[model samples]
Target: MAGAGLKGARERRVRTGGIELCVAELGDADRPTVLLVHGYPDSKEVWSEVAVRLAEEFHVVLYDVRGHGRSTAPAPLRGGFTLEKLTDDFLAVADAVSPDRPVHLVGHDWGSVQSWEFVTVPRTEGRIASFTSLSGPSLDHFGHWIKSRMARPTPRRIGQLLGQGAKSWYVYLLQTPVLPELAWRGPLGKRWPKLLERVEKVPAGDYPTPSLPQDAATGAWLYRDNVRARLSRPRPDAFAHVPVQLITPTGDAFLSERLYDDLGTWVPELTRRTLPAKHWVPRTRPDQLSAWIGDFVRTHEEPATRAPRPVAEAAVRSGVRPEYAERFGGQLVLVTGAASGIGRATAFAFAEAGARVVAVDRDAEGAARTAEMARLIGAPEAWGEAVDVSDEQAMEKLAATVAAEYGIVDVLVNNAGIGLTGSFLETTSEEWKRVLDVNLWGVIHGCRIFGAQMAARGQGGHIVNTASAAAFQPSRALPAYNTSKAAVLMLSECLRAELAGRSIGVSAICPGIVNTNITATTRFAGVSDTAEEKRRQRKASRLYGLRNYPPEKVADAILGAVLHDRAVVPVTPEARGVHALSRLAPGALRALARWQPPA
Candidate 1:
C-alpha cells in the first residue's frame, strides 16, 4: 500500500564482495524488487526518489556503490574500486537482495556500466530481468569513441587536445600518493567550491557537497584502474545478453550524445530513450523518467498473466515518439546571468532551437536587451527579470512566480558566477565567503526550490550550474575562486546521488574563458592597488584571449551535456588540457604550477 506520509527512506549497511555498501530501501519486501546502483563519487541516496516511484510497483533497493556515499572503504582504498570488483559487489548485493527472483536493475553513470556487466555475466544473468542504464557507457564503446574522435584531421586537433587534457588532470592527480589526501583533507577541501565547481555540469540538479570528509580514495581507485589504464583490457564476455534500456539526456557534457551513435551494435535488444535532461538525470528528470519507465514497461515488457502479445501487436503497435521529433519545441527556459556570456548566448541558442526564454540577470536593462535579441532570433517567448544571483530568498520567490505564471519551469540555468585572480594569501575572508555564497550557494538554493517542485509535478526538468575550469585543477594563485568552484562541483555530485530516483536532470558547466564580461566585474586582491595583481590579470587575460571562443559555443555545449546527461564537461582548450594532465600526472602539474609563470 502507498502510505500517506512516508518518512525519508532508511539506509541499510551491508557487505557485498569485500566492501561495505550503504543500501537504502522502500516498500514491502514481498513486492517485485528493483535494485538501483549509483555511479562514481556518489552513493545510494541518489536513488531515493526513483526508488519511491518504483516502490509503487515493486520493492526498491538503492545502495551506495562501494567507496561512495555512506559505504565503508576497504583497506588499501585505491585497489577496491576497480570495475571488476564493483561488478562483483553488484552481484553480491543482487544475491542478497533478491536471490531467487530476477531483479529489475537500474544504474546511472558508473552504475550503468556495472549493471551492464552484471546482466551479461554468466553467473549474475539469472538474477536480472531488466536493466536500465542512465548516462552510462560500455567501457569498450567509450574507448572506441575517444579513439575515433582523435583520428580526425589537424583542424580538429584542438578538440582532441582538449579532450585529452580534460581527462588527463584527474589521472595525473592519481599518480600522487600524498597530494590527493592533502587535497581532500587540507585547504582544497575547504575551498572545494572553486576547485570542484567546474566539474559539476549535469542538466537536472547538481550533486550535493556536504562540508565534510568523504572517502574519495576508493572512487579514485576506479579511475586508476579504468580511465588511467585506458579501458584497453577486454571486458568480460558475458555482457551481450542483458535486456537493457538506455536513457541518454540530450545535454550531457562529459559523454556526448554522439557516444550513443553506435550503441545498438553492442546492445541489440536495447530500448533507447532520450530526455532533454542533463547528467544528473535521476534528480532533475525523475517524473519524466518515471512516466517514461511506466510506458517502457507497458510497451516492452511481456506480462506474466497475459500470454506474450501477438506478433502483429508487438511489431506494429505504436510506441513513444522518436526523439528526433519536434515535441521538444517551445519548452520554457529560464537562464540566469543572461545578458552576455553563456547565459545570454544560451538564451538565444534555445530561441534558435524553438524554446521560449525567460532571461534573468542583475542587469535588468541588459537582460531586457538579451530578451529583445532572443525575440529577434525567433523565440516564441522571451522575457527579462532583474535579480541578484546570490540572494537565495529572491531566487526562491522568483522560482515560485515563474512556476505560478508559466506552469512549470522546464529548464533552469544558474549561470551567474564571478572569477578571481591571485594566490590564496591574497584572498580576504570576506572575498572567499562572497565567492562561495554566490557561485556555490546560488546553485544550491535554485536546486532546492525548483527541484522540489519539479519532483512533485513528475513531468521532469533540467538544472544547469556554471562552474569553472579550476574545478578539477588545484592552483595556488586562484585558491579562493578555485575553492568555491570546487564546492559547487561537489555539491552537484552529491545532488546527483540524492535526486536521481526522481528523474530530475542536473548538470554543472565547467568552461574556460569564453569571451565573457566577467573579467570587467571581477573583484580580486591587488587588482586596483597592487601592480603585481593587475599585471597577472592582464597577462592571464591576454593569454586567454588567444582562445577567444564565443559564449554561444559554450551554450551549445551546455545543451549537449544536458541532452545526454553527461556528468563532467570541459569547455575550453586549457580546461581540457588541465583536466587530462592532472589525472595522468598530478605531481608534474603541481611542479608546473609551482614554477613561477615564465617571466
Candidate 2:
C-alpha cells in the first residue's frame, strides 16, 4: 500500500458492501475534499499524478474500487459490480473521507461511468458537490443516444451508430464469458502496459500496478452485470443534481465526440473541454488535466448559493465565439508583436476561441489597445506587455512574469518582424542588423523563453512563427527581408523536429503580399535621401493596398496550422503557388526574382 507511488499519502481502510476498500488521503483534511475514483483495469495509483497536484489546495482522496487494487472483491463475480453497488461504494467512501462536508468528485473512464450514477441518483444528493468526468459518459444517456439513433435510422444517425459501434469493438470482446478473464490473467495483462505506452503515449512506470491481472480478470463483471440491462432499459430519471465538467479527449479511441451532443439536455449546468490527446489522458496529459481539475474544483468550492457559473453561460455572457471553443477555451496564448497586423488579428482570433491572451508588443499603447479589444472579443482574461522581442533579457523577464501570473503558456506566436527592401549589394550592414534583429532574433528569443516554460511544464504546446513568401521564393529587391524570413522558416523546421517527441509543435506560417502596415514602414536601402525612402515606402504600401488581401486571413491560417500541427503553411494563393514552384521550377523562380520593381 505504501509503495503505490502516491508520495506523502495517509492510508486507511473503509468497509462497505462486504468489501474492504483501500483509501489514501493527501493535504489537510479540513480543506475542500476532492475525491478521485480510478477507472477499470486500474487502481488508486491511476490518480497518483493528479492527486499530488490537487493536494496543494484541497484535501485529495483516492480509493480502489472493489477487486481493483488493494480492495477486497465480493464473494461472487457474476453480479458483484452493479451500478447500485458502485453507488453504495461511493457513498460509503464519501462518508468515511469527508463525513461533515460534500466531496467534489473526479473520475476517469469507468470511474466516471459509476460516478455519474453517484451524482445522478436521488439518494446521493448533497453528498457530492460537483463532478468532473473524463473520457467517459453516463450509461443511461449513452443508452438513450443509441436508441434514438437506431430508431431514427437516418443516414447521419446510422453512420454515427456504425462509427461508435466500431470504436466499441473491445466492449463486445469483454462481454464474452470466460475468454476475457482468461486473457487478462495470461499474456494480455503482461503486455497491457507496453501496449498503452506505444499506442496511447502513456509514460511507462508504476501505473497499471501488479494487481492488474486479477483486477482485470474480476472487473469483467462490471460490464457483464450492468451494460446489457442498462442499455435495454436505461433509467429515464437520470439527471445531474450538480454542475458537471466533461473533459473529452478528442483522440479517444473508445468514444466518439458525438456521444455528448445532447448532453446539455441531461445536465443543466455543463462545461465542455476538449484535449488533443488519446485516451489514457491521466498518464499522458496530467499537467493540463490537473490545471483544469483544480480550476473546476476551486470554482465550485464556493458556497452552493454562489457556485461559479457554467462555462457555456459565461461564454454567452462574454460573447465568446462558439467555433473551436472546446479546443481553445481557457487556454493561455501569448503572442509577440500583437499590437498590429497579423499579430493583432491572430490575438483576436484566439480571443474569439475563448483563450486567455497575453498581448505583447514593443509599442505600449498598441499592446494595451489590442488587449482591450481581445477582452471585448471574448478572452476571459487579457493583458498587455511592452517588450522588444529582439532583447533577450526583456523576453526572459516577460516570460517569468507571464508564468508567475498566468501559468504556463499553451500557445506562443512569434510574429514580430521588420521589413527591408534592397538588392544584396545595396543593402547596408545597419539595415541587415535591424531586419534580422526584429525578424530572426525576435523569433529566437520568443521560442527560447516561452518554449522552455512549455517543455519544462511537461505538457504539450504549440509555437507559430510568422515567415513570409520570400522565405522560400527568392526576391532580389527584398534581400534583407528575404534572408531574415528564410532563417525563420529553417529555424521553425529544425525546432519542429527537435520538439516532436516532447509534444511541442512548431509551425512556420508564410504569407504572400497582404494589405498591412509593414509596407508603410519598410526601409529602402538604396535611397540617397529620407524623402526618396519615404516615397518608396508609399509606393510599396499602395501596391499592397491594391492587392487588398486581409491580415485576418493570415490569422486564420496561423490557427489552422497549429490545429493541424503543420510544419510549413503557405497562406495565400500566390504563396502556395510559389512554394510549389520553388521546389519544382527553380529556374522560373530565379528568373522572377531578377525582375526589379518600380521605386
> Best candidate, lDDT-wise?
2
lDDT of 2 at 24: 94
Best by TM-score: 2
After superposition, the stretches of candidate 2 with alpha carbons farther than 4 Å from their true spots are: 1-3, 303-317, 330-412, 428-463, 469-477, 483-557, 560-599
Query: lDDT (CA) for every model shown?
Result: 0.68, 0.87
- Please give the lDDT score for candidate 1: 0.68
RMSD (CA, Å), candidate 2 to true, equals 5.6
**TM-score of every model versus the real structure:** 0.50, 0.77
Which residue segments of model 1 deviate by more than 4 Å? 1-11, 147-176, 187-212, 236-239, 297-302, 305-321, 324-599
Looking at model 2, the pairs that clash are none
Q: Residue 539 in model 1: shift from native, Å?
A: 73
Candidate 1, residues 1-599: lDDT per residue as tens digits?
Answer: 11111245545667766568766667777666778887755556556556667677666787777666666677776566666777778777777777767777888887886666676667765677778888877776666556655666465554664654574465578667677766766675565544333433232332443422364544656666676454554353534576777777765655666667767767767776666556666665554455445434434343662223234333222331233112233467889889887899888767665456889998999999998877766554578988887898898888888876654677778898887666677777788888887888888887888888776665567788888888877777678788888887778778877777767677878897778777655666645566665665566667656768888779878877766777778888878888788789888777766654442
